[model samples]
Target: MDAVARVRWAQVGAGGHVARRTSAWWERLVAAREGRAPQRLVHAVLEVVVDGSVRSVDMAPTWGRSAGARRVVVTGPVGSRLLGWWPLFRYELRVVDAPAPPDHVLHVSDDLPLPADVLDDLALVPALTWGRDEAGAGDMWTSNSVVSWLLERHGVTSVGPPAGHRAPGWDAGRCVARR
Candidate 1:
């Protein structure tokens, strides 16, 4: 493979239970050279902490640190994240540890509302998840692509593939389905 191709592949990443780094020098160096801020969604970003019987859910800062969260669960293979933190990225679900209290956690999944509490406590949060085609190169994509893809099962056409730099934003006037 060519040098440029290899570098792009590094950015797309492989997905199979990869853990996150406190720091990634290569990603940082590239960001510096590009002179661009990390890609992040300006939409729903919430924090949820599940303790014994009760779940505390709230809106989190746009670039909140999930490191402070206590426990995390994920549905699919995870990988290192280049942009800011979000529940959809699986960065929040990198481990399976017991929670102490006042914890933040995420469960990345193809399914939603996967039994967090005896009752429902699902709320919309600003988040993003990026993925690449199985080949992991120019086919890199992001955001609610899975949802868009799944729509096809229900007879909804996927208008187009997700944009490579997507971190879907929300507004009162705009609907996610239309994206």
Candidate 2:
């Protein structure tokens, strides 16, 4: 474990046009069916300052096997090569050095004082099945789940989305990690 000076979590809007639109529409539909107003949807990513440099931890679509260290690719049902969707369902668990947060960020959590051991554990996140309700948390596994899972694994439980926004599949990740 190196000297981790700062750690924070960000809630950002979906980066892709289709993803943003689809997520918003789905949230609206679910909220209406449940008789509640829709909350804005966001995704979670972590930023850790170790040895005076920033490292980003996030899960994102592979987009044709982009290369980087500390990246692990996980398969999704619809995006699997067996389903003829080679890169579509492929996701990478990225621990990128000196990375910037994605565009359209909604909220950034205050810097959290996490142990160096916790930051070290980021590279060891489980390769859970993406887009599946395997955790029985009543939601599919997603990028949000990955963030939550990593946090819960290291006993960092106080972080979550800010006001007026929701991180879908977050509970699923925590639930799975608890097991």
Model 2 TM-score, all chains together: 0.79
lDDT of 1 by residue, 1-179 (tens): 10000000011222222312322443455457779654312111122234433232222223355566433332232233453344444433222233223212122212122233311212121233334333222222232333332233333342322233222222111233333
lDDT of 2 by residue, 7-61 (tens): 3434344556776787788899989988999988777777777657777776777
User: In model 1, what is the error at residue 148, expressed in angstroms?
Assistant: 1.1
Off by over 4 Å in 2: 1-16, 68-70, 73-85, 117-120
- What TM-score do all the candidates reach, one by one? 0.23, 0.79
- Model 2, residue 96: displacement in angstroms? 0.8
Q: On a 0 to 100 scale, what is the lDDT of residue 135 in model 1?
A: 26
Model 2: per-residue Cα lDDT at residue 24 = 81
Task: List lDDT for all candidates, in order.
Answer: 0.28, 0.68
- TM-score winner among the candidates? 2
